[model samples]
Target: MFRVVTPKNDQEFEKYFAFRWQYLRQPWNFPPGSEKDEYEQVAEHRMIVNSEGEVVACGRVHMNTAEEAQIRHIAVHSAYHRRGLGQMMLGALEAVARDQGAIRAVTNSREISIPFFSSCGFVIEREAPTELGLLKRQQMVKKLTDLSSLVLHPKWCTELQKTWSETIPITEHMGIKLHQYTGKTLETRASLNKNINVHGTMFAGSIFSLATLTGWGMIFLQLKEKQLEGDIVLGDGDIHYHKPITMRPRAKCNIESLSGKFSILESNKKCKITLQVNILDDDTPVAEFKGVYWILPGKEASDAKRT
Candidate 1:
């Protein structure tokens, strides 16, 4: 397995800088110090180390706006290329940007690396000047959280939003909105001002609520994708607060882990699954939610029996 983290000591950072130079600059005949740029000090950086404690990959991201961040200097050691280390480092950097309240990520990718970047969900926005002796670059961007493309149907999206607003009146008050339902993951956002407490930060209760609903929505979307109908409910759950959320908080739940639980439903007509939801602020995990959810085939189906 690979471990990713920000370099905390001089030795680790030296290795990180060396790895970048080896992969990105040295091959192009650039000097040693050319791997870094003006953003190093202010940017969020991530280093991935192998089991031997050698830094294998590195990348950096810095805020361009409250809702946007730019990624730069992504490099992976030649020895580890094509092994997915670069994508892992990119994901870590994107997570950092998302926790920082950025809803989008931008990067200028070298032409040789375009396919790799595309595999990680970045799309070319425009082509720009070739730099450092004909290294072609393309301006690319990835939406951190947006529903327009993910939502399968406009009417369904509208109805889901309406249902949440009416059934859970507090959702409307807190300005909670469904951001996307990509079948694999479900995401929602809540306005900071509406959910803020006397401390002028997101309330713990609001965070829990958002996480709970996001998890439930994941199952709901999965049912729709399979052309199946189900009533989803949270049976038991817990939330952990790790950091304070200062901006509009986003909650996301990945349903892949529950694939086995869904298979059980096909055989038994109902299944209970456990899912985890995460709340992010600025690229850091502020809260975590673990929940047990029950799904039944129809309104008339009995509540799921614990097994």
Candidate 2:
């Protein structure tokens, strides 16, 4: 097994820089010290180490402004490709950025790595300057904030939990419960023991259900925060399972990923919104879910259809 860590002592720092140089600088024929920058003293660094104490991946993040952070020096050992260590390292760097009050993160990624960064919730904003006047790069950005236009209240979370238990009886049986809500982000979790499959991992169907409700809950809170009445339903959804979950399953939905118009609901018209939910195994993204939700006019309209 591999673990993510921060280099503290002199020996660990030596190994960390050497690993960064090997994958990031050496391949481009750059000198040894080219792997590091002046921000080393102010930036946050993370690396993944194998059981044998070898560093397989490393990255760094530094605040460029009070609300903006820049990620740099991302490198993963060739032998450790496709193991999700890159995402794990990015997660650690972003966490540090958030703690330091950064609301967004930016990175200059090579053309070959744009797709990998996109899968981690980054979008290309524009073309960045070439590296060493050779490799073309793209400027990518990702939001790190949980704040939205609507203010969140603790009582809203309580009401959402009650609605789930009373309306969807299956949520209780599946062990789904609201884990947290930070106004713009809603986090929920399900018990692995209750939803485990024959393969000894979280059932695919259970993961879908967990992610579905988490997205639904975010929309539900948004409407409640705006004091708008509506009947929300899952119009459609797609989930990509990157890895199995042997531990308890948790899903997080952010308002930053939300797009669409909710104003039409005030005119008694249906509206649609799309959002994403990330299923995590202790800060590592294990699955990604994008969902389209529809909000019908009001509770009366929903009740009329059933009648």
Candidate 3:
């Protein structure tokens, strides 16, 4: 269980501020008070406390414009790395940004942290030069809302959830949840408790299933967008386990490669399209899945039934 909280009082704020300084500033030999700045009073601060009541992660988000916010001082105790606490804090900060009507969240991420930020839906805007020119940093941005308004209806996502829960019993057993689906991306998540292995990491099979279903979900929405009814099935698939997922498992499918496949299906009645899905633990890829899917149009299915 992780708790994201804003320091409710001075005592909590001290712990939160101290954690940030210890992990981020002290290691760099920055002065004691360097961890804080003038923005402390205006920025929204958040931290994650372990069940033991120790602050393990901290970050801040400040609105830079009516539609944009900047995230800074994202730090997690080294002992808490890879546990998804940083990602949890990011989500909390992004939630604050959204509530403030900000459409975009920007941050200057350390080079080592780029993958984590990317996994959280941030894209690299540019690389910035540091003071010493020895270390690399990046300007990253994450879209807080569907600015293009390409989100599908809630009914479709709800129905898709029902279809998986009922038709795929293991999806229900794994506790899979639909996180989001936009114009070209489909995201899903599974609880670690339901899918954990003896090694205390997420089971590989669960990761593959999440990836496969995310790709299928993308095709499902694609069919709806084209106003075509089809039966989508996995024709074949290959998965590479990059690392053991120790946190909540999430999968994403981006559809840039999905373009023009519809033309093949329109001409052939059935088409096999390949999609790549990534399983990430807070933007770190734990597994990669490439699945070839077969989409059979309604007319093609009826014709086969008559044969």
lDDT of 3: 0.78
Return the candidate ranking by TM-score, descending: 1, 3, 2
TM-score of 2: 0.53
Report residue 26 deviation for candidate 2 (angstroms).
27
TM-score-wise, the better of 1 and 3 is 1
Displacement of residue 250 (Cα, Å) in model 3 is 0.6
Cα error of candidate 3 at position 223, Å: 0.6
For 210-277, candidate 1 gives per-residue lDDT tens digits of 98888877776666667666667778989889899996598866553453356656665767878788
Measured against the true structure, the TM-scores of the candidates, in listed sequence, are: 0.64, 0.53, 0.54
Report model 3's TM-score to 2 decimal places. Answer: 0.54
Q: Model 2, 212-233: lDDT tens per residue?
A: 9999999999888778878888
Query: Which is superior by TM-score, 1 or 2?
Result: 1
Off by over 4 Å in 2: 1-152, 303-307
